[model samples]
Target: MDSTKCLPRLGGDSSFELGLECREIAKTIKTRKIKYFGHIKRHTSFLKDVLEGKIEGSRIRGRQRRQWVDDIAEWTGKGIRQCTVEAQDREKLRSVSCQPLEQGRLRE
Candidate 1:
């Protein structure tokens, strides 16, 4: 039970022969966020308000920070308003969220 033996070795032909591939962390995170947006949209709760950046507060006056919705909008290549409409349909949202960014746009 050697610890070194349990870990996948780095930069070797064996690693390739084993068919190991590096996961795209950013893509994975973005996909999960998109899925969570769908989940929030399907529910009737304050979480929706929070997700939409409607919290009660004043910002420190420099520049506005990006909202959670903003990332989803960019990733999905659709306006926030349109995303809201599409997110209402769970099956469609699931399909859109899991697709690669290039093909994730809502069908016209």
Candidate 2:
């Protein structure tokens, strides 16, 4: 609760004077933590949530590349571990498409 809550605003009073009354007032109310999605890490978390079905995105409709992860887990419940496996699969696919003929020629 205190993680994102204000703690008496560093001490103050309703009359704009330094007093303990204001401190008590601020402590009574609770504050909520902020949730935002930024960068790949956050996307990965959202992907986890997708697998858990904690949030709804299928109703979003259309081509949901970012939200596409949600549909994949809709039928089968998946977790971050599955996401990791899928990433490895993609890497393998990528490696298969590349040509390694120049590797020996470029090396000593």
Candidate 3:
């Protein structure tokens, strides 16, 4: 049996650790989401209203689904208002978004 086949190989790194790769990918995704949200925040558009849940709709039965902003808040360990405020500053948003997964209690 080839042990290498069972592990993910990162570029130029002999160590094949799937957990590390997953963390990296998660960070990248978080960063992108933050940046995108920031962009939306700076603009006046339907998407913004949608993200903010401004659009009135009938409530669905059962547990409420998590919104994008909720995910951002959870990822940054901040409230929705704080996340929106931070998103206003590009540099701060980038820094917050790049934080390690452990720093943010990500829900499974």
Q: Whose lDDT is greatest here?
A: 3
Off by over 4 Å in 3: 1-16, 100-108
| Model 1: per-residue Cα lDDT over 46-107, one tens digit each | 88767765556876898888666877888888899988998999888888788747533322
**Model 2: per-residue Cα lDDT over 47-105, one tens digit each:** 54554465445456677455433322331234444533443454532332232222211
Which candidate model has the greater lDDT, 1 or 2? 1
lDDT tens digits, residue span 1-108, model 3: 655556564665534566677777777777788788888987889888787765468887999887767877777778888878877888888787677346664456
Candidate 2 global lDDT: 0.33
Q: Which candidate is the best by TM-score?
A: 3
In candidate 1, how many clashes are counted? 0
TM-score, cand. 2 vs. native: 0.18
Model 1 worst lDDT run, 10 consecutive residues: 99-108
Comparing 1 and 2 on TM-score, the stronger one: 1
Question: lDDT (CA) for every model shown?
Answer: 0.74, 0.33, 0.75
Error of 1 at 105 (Å): 16
Candidate 2: clashing pairs of residues:
none
Native-referenced Cα lDDT, model 3: 0.75
- Supply every candidate's count of residue pairs whose N, Cα or C atoms clash at under 3 angstroms: 0, 0, 0
Off by over 4 Å in 2: 1-66, 90-108
